[model samples]
Target chain A: MITIDGVTKIRGRTRILHEVSFTARPGRVTGFLGPNGAGKTSTLRVLLGLDRPQAGTALIDGRRYADHDRPLTVAGALLDGSGAHRSRSARAHLRWVAASNGLPRARVEEVLDLVGLSADAGKRAGRFSLGMGRRLGLATALLGDPPVLILDEPVNGLDPAGIRWMRTFLRDSAATGRTVLLSSHLMGELAETADDVVIIDRGRVVAAGTLAEVVGEHATLEDAFLDRTASEGVSW
Target chain B: MTGPRRVAGAVHAEAIKLITLPSLALTVALTWALTALLGLTGRPGGVLVYTQVGFLVLGVLAATHEYQGGGQIRASLLAVPRRPLLAVAKIVALAGIAAPFALVAAVLAGRPGATGGLLLDLVLAAGVGMLVKHSVGATGLVLTAYEIVSPLVRTHLPEVARLPSSAWTAAVLLVAIAIFARREA
Candidate 1:
């Protein structure tokens, strides 16, 4: 389970997130949806303990992410690229992260195979294409097989088939009772995959509920999102 | 509480990172080559200076390697969430490499410098790289201070400059540790 309560973040003079509160329960996929620069990444970063919030707590199973002795085993996170140094191959990269968390070396090969990167396991991360990089990033995230998985822009660079594969993978993970929370700018993607949805706009949670609830009285999630996020400006 | 096992895991991970780095092998090979060539050419003191530069760069290489993928640092921080422990693990891994390399370099170069000092330089350079966040800038800054400023300051405070290389390295390393612990990954 993941809980983020009253998470307010201020960067420079601008308030990036204002008392953002939400919960992602296990056995379901929680889709965090927002437009670009809407603080999706920022919130995920705070949850992962990469960035500190001015006021709030992001907890994985009732404890801050950093409080766990084996954080990887508690939560597996993927943010931005493959998270592998350009010089290191995929297997080498996974091996070290595994060693840091005292995971078995066998898990590395397993995740590589799981992500369909076994053929390219020895390839350096820098040489990977965008799709391959996302696969590697997913592979890394699966290394620990943690109960909670947090991903930011999880399908940003995937091909259609890869996208379908990721959707199925995420669904399967949730079906197995994993708490899977992912942020995406793609409304259609989230609408198809997410059982629970939280919509953030201008750094605040504009709306949040189950997909059917949030989509009530609207044609689609896109319509709901557009309706809720129509900001104080000239409209087209 | 983080057990010794956790710390060992972090350090082992860091060592693996350094070992896998292509630049690390290049730097080590270059340092070894310089130690042999200059020592054979009968410039014992000169051998140490060159060896120092190579190891200093090696330290920075180990550190800067973390910052390369942009997300690699995040991955590391996530793996070992205790920031100070992570920093210590980095230097520990660095020292693990530099200590043996220093012993060999000292033997090859023959009395040009102390092995302890050589190892300190390499480890300190890694700490500086953590602070500077770039290989060239961090290593260059340390190189300038140790090579250029020390020599210039030595003429005025002969005893101070001669004695405090380790002290200066310690100060840099301590400051770097504090920054690494406090800074956002």
Candidate 2:
């Protein structure tokens, strides 16, 4: 489970997150929906302990992310890019991350196969196309088989087949009782995959609940998102 | 994993990263070739000092490589969140890779005692690289200070020149560590 309680982040004089609070429960796929620059990434960063917040806290499994002795085993995160050096082969990249958390070397190849990147394991990350890069990123996130997974823009460049594969993968991951929190601007994708939704706009939670509750009177999730965000009068 | 084991893993990872960089191979080969050429000609005077530029580039690249392209610094921090440990691991990795090269260059130049100075130069380069955060910018700054500014200072301010390079290197390294430890990745 992930709990973000009244987390506020200020970058310089501008506030990026204002009392942002939400929960991603286990055994469910929680879609973090927002337009660009809506603080989704910032909130995730704080949750991962990458950025310190000025108020409140973000916890995974009842403790701060940094407090975990083996953080990867507690929560695996995929944030922007492939997260590997451009010159590094996919295998070398995973090996290093696994080693950092004391995970066995074998897990590297396991995840490679899991993400269908085993054939491209030896290729330098810089050479991989966008879909390949996202797969590699997902492989890294699965290295520790943690109970929670957090990904930002996981389908930015995937083809239709890759997108379908990802949707099934995320659903299956949640079905197996892992807490999956993914942020995306793709409302259709969220409508298909998300069991719950947390919508934020202009650094604040506009609405959050199960798909039905949040979508209420709107004809679709996209319509609901447009209405909620447009109410704030901010251009996305 | 124990702290030592985690640190060891981080060091190994860092070492792999350094060796795989095309820049590392380029810098080392260039530095060695230049050093060999200067030694062969026996016109080694001040040229030997400039050879340290190669290793200095190596050091700078070592520190700034992760920031290149889309930047792997975020990935690195995610893998190992403890900033101090990550910084130590990087330093240990660079020292390990640089020490042998420094020794070999010193021997080739027939000034084995200068090995210490070369190592100090590597540390100084890495420190400046961390501060600057851009490989090209760090390289330019380090080379200018070492080749042009230091020479001018030594020529005009003898007392200042009397201060050991080791002291400056140490001070810079300390500042680098403090900045790295506190900075958000």
Candidate 3:
């Protein structure tokens, strides 16, 4: 389980996250929905221990991420890019991350197969297409088979078929009792995949609950998101 | 995994990263060519100065590669949240990669005993690169300080030259390590 309480972040004079709070329960996929400049990524960064929050705490399994002896084995994260150096081959890239966590070399091939990048494992990351890059990033996140998965915009460059595959993959991951928190602007995708939703706007949480609870009175999740965030003074 | 094993893993990962970079070959070739040219010119210190520039670039590349192409720094920090371990791993890996080339450069420059100095230059360059966070900017700053500022200072204050080169390198490296440990990725 991932718990964030009263998390606030200030970069320079501008506030990025304002006492943000949410919990991603185990055995569920939580959709972190927000607009372009919203605090979604910022919140994820703090949870991953990449960025420090000025106030409050983010905990995974009741312990700070940094405090975990085996952080990768506790929570695997997939952030913005592929996270592999451009010149490094996918195989080489995975090998190193696996080594970092003392994961077996077999895990490398397993993840590559899982992501459907087995054929191009020898190819440099810079040569991969956007969709391929996303796959590689996902493979890295699944390297340790961590119980909690945090992905930021996981489907940004995937095709329709790839997107559908990801939806099923995430659902299965959650069904296995893992905690999955993914942030995306695609409401239809989240509606199909996420069991819970947390919507934020202008650095604050506007609504958060189960899919049905938050979507009440609206024709769709997108419509409800538009209404909630629009009321928060966000134009378009 | 134990701390030592984790450190070893990080070093291995960093070494792989440094080797795969296309610029590494170019930088090594440049260093050798410059060393050879200076060796022929019969200016003993000139060879060290010129060849060290290439070593400095190696250091800069080692530090800034994490920030390249949308950044692998996030991935690195995620894999190993212990920043101090990560920083040390990088330094060790960079030094390992630079040792052979530094040795070759020293031989070509006719100051084979200066291999230690060349290694020190590599570490110092990497440290400055970490602080600056941009390869081009770090390279320019290091080059200016070494080629221009250091000479001017040495000419004005001869006593400054009495300080061991390792002391300055160690000081820069310590500051880099502190920043790496404290700063947010």
Q: By TM-score, who's the top model here?
A: 1
Model 2, runs deviating above 4 Å: A234-236, B44-47
Off by over 4 Å in 3: B37-46
Compute each candidate's TM-score over C-alphas.
Answer: 0.97, 0.95, 0.95
lDDT of 3 by residue, A1-236 (tens): 99999999999999999999999999999999998989999999999888999999999999989788778889988888899889888998898888777888999999999999999999999999999999999999999999999999998989999999989999999999999999999999999999999999999999999999999999999999999988736454
DockQ score, prediction 3? 0.67
Model 3 RMSD in angstroms: 1.7
lDDT of 3 by residue, B18-81 (tens): 7777788789988898889878878844677788888888888889878888468888999888
| lDDT of predicted model 3 | 0.90
Chain B TM-score of every predicted model = 0.92, 0.92, 0.93
- Better model by TM-score, 1 or 3? 1
Every candidate's CA RMSD:
1.5, 1.7, 1.7
| Candidate 2: residue pairs that collide | none
DockQ of each: 0.74, 0.54, 0.67
Which residue pairs in candidate 3 collide? none
Best candidate according to lDDT: 3
Q: What DockQ number belongs to candidate 2?
A: 0.54
Q: Is the docking of candidate 3 incorrect, acceptable, medium or high quality?
A: medium
